[model samples]
Target: MRYNIIHRTTYKYESPVTVGHYMARLEPRTLPFQECPWHELTIFPSPIERAERSDYFGNTNVYFEIEGSHQKLEVIARSLVEVIRAQPFDPASTPPWETIRDSCRSDVYNPATPAGELTFASTLIPVGVPYADYARPSFLPGRPILQGVCDLNRRIHRDFVFDPKATDAATPVEKVLKQRRGVCQDFAQVMIACLRSLGLPARYVSGYLETVPPPGVVKLVGADASHAWVSVYCGEVCGWMDADPTNDVLPSERHITVAWGRDFADVSPLRGVTTGAGEQRLKVAVDVLPDKD
Candidate 1:
């Protein structure tokens, strides 16, 4: 399947005086099952200096600086991508969850291997007794890793409510766990915390998910929004598998990959700093449309 994605962000400052610098991780990734042939980032009141590079996690990042003062700033990213659905596999066929945990524990530390690095705590995700206890039920002794992960994913979906206003980027994982309500970001972080607490490698993924309308209903432009999910390291043979606890299913063609890291802080879609600014109003609109050509 082919898709055209548009993400637009605008910030209006009550008082603008000086410089601004920003970093964007909005480019779609190219994976074995995904291809991005075109992409472009447009900034209003073009920056004085801009550069592109790959981050520690191999994600494409764009950095730009604006020296002139302005009351409004707009950043838009457009891309065309093709995604192939992964073939389904039996979760029971995966190795035991304990074995994978042990392997991560015993393996030598290697930054080149993200799976090992991801097994420990990160900025937003914490590993503690509470998280391990919460995840222990699904990962009983000798349970297949993927099977246990899937069960945990389903349990989260069944237990939590998707409330957009319940949490913010700074909200701790412990709070989300206690409240049992949040948007996709909260669910993904909570799941990551659970897996990492048990010595499992799980990364936070940021991207877009196609939202289909009801039968015979026309899709609304800008109705789609950014999405977050988790990717588990299932072992050498099976490799990384994406799971959407927010939707309770394995990601497929409908899920477009953007960037991933230990947690959302590492791969936030957009982050920046301003030299002088007062109250700010921000607006974001996203569209993920099927492409025909």
Candidate 2:
């Protein structure tokens, strides 16, 4: 499926900013499952200096500096991407949860992926009392699919509320789980942390959400918005399965990939530092339109 995405962000300052800087991670990367045909960005009152580089996590970073007093700043990003993701429901010969767990041991669990990336660490994802107790040896390994790393994805959907204002980017996973409310980013992070606690590799994903309109109704334009999810490596055959605990669904034709990384900090669409700006307000708007072809 193909989509044309338009995203605009504007910043207003109470006082004119003499100097400002920003880091942008809006470019999409080509993966085994997705493709990027064209992508570009434009900033209003163009900055005097700009630089681009790739972060450690493989996300593209655009940095810019603006000099001279300015009351407002605007950044616009547009992209046309052709995404071809695999169907989650595709039948395979992989063993079920029971057979897989029986062949695996708790001590042998490691969260590193085949590529040698540490997908999860204890510091990032601590195992709570309930989680540790539930995975003990006395329990029936096959029966407690809810005890291990794989269960983090489903547990989040079953336990939390999709509250947009419930938390912010800095909120911790324990807090999110305790409150049982947050947006897609929050849910994705919690899942990432939980999976890592259980020694599994997980990563955060950023993209666009495709809205499904009622029958016979044309999909609402601009109704679509930015979305976040998590991808966990579930062994050799299953590879990485994208899960959206916020919506309790898998990535389909509707999910458009923009970027991915270990966490939001690694793939935030826009972030940066500034000088001479006492305070600033930000406004953002996103539109996802289906291609006619």
Q: How many clashes in each candidate? A: 0, 0
Q: After superposition, how far is residue 223 of candidate 2 from its true place, in Å?
A: 3.6
Alpha-carbon lDDT of model 2:
0.69
- Worst-scoring 10-residue span by lDDT in model 1: 106-115
Global lDDT scores for all candidate models:
0.92, 0.69
After superposition, which runs of candidate 1 have C-alpha atoms over 4 Å from their true positions?
Answer: 107-114
In candidate 2, list every pair of residues with a backbone clash.
Answer: none
Q: Which pairs, if any, clash in model 1? A: none
Tens digits of lDDT, candidate 1, 1-293: 99999999999999983899999999999999999999999998799999999999899999999887898999999999999976966899998998888777775653325577788899889999998999999999999999999999999999999998999889999999999999999999999999999999999999999999999999988999999999999987789999999999999999999999999999988889998879998889999999978
**lDDT by residue (tens digit), candidate 2, 1-293:** 88788888888888878888899877767777777788898997789999998877677789998888888888888988777876554423433434433333334544322423533343334445544343233223443332333344556787788887888777876787678899988888777766554444567889888677799998655566678998765455666677788777777877877777777777778876666667788888888877788
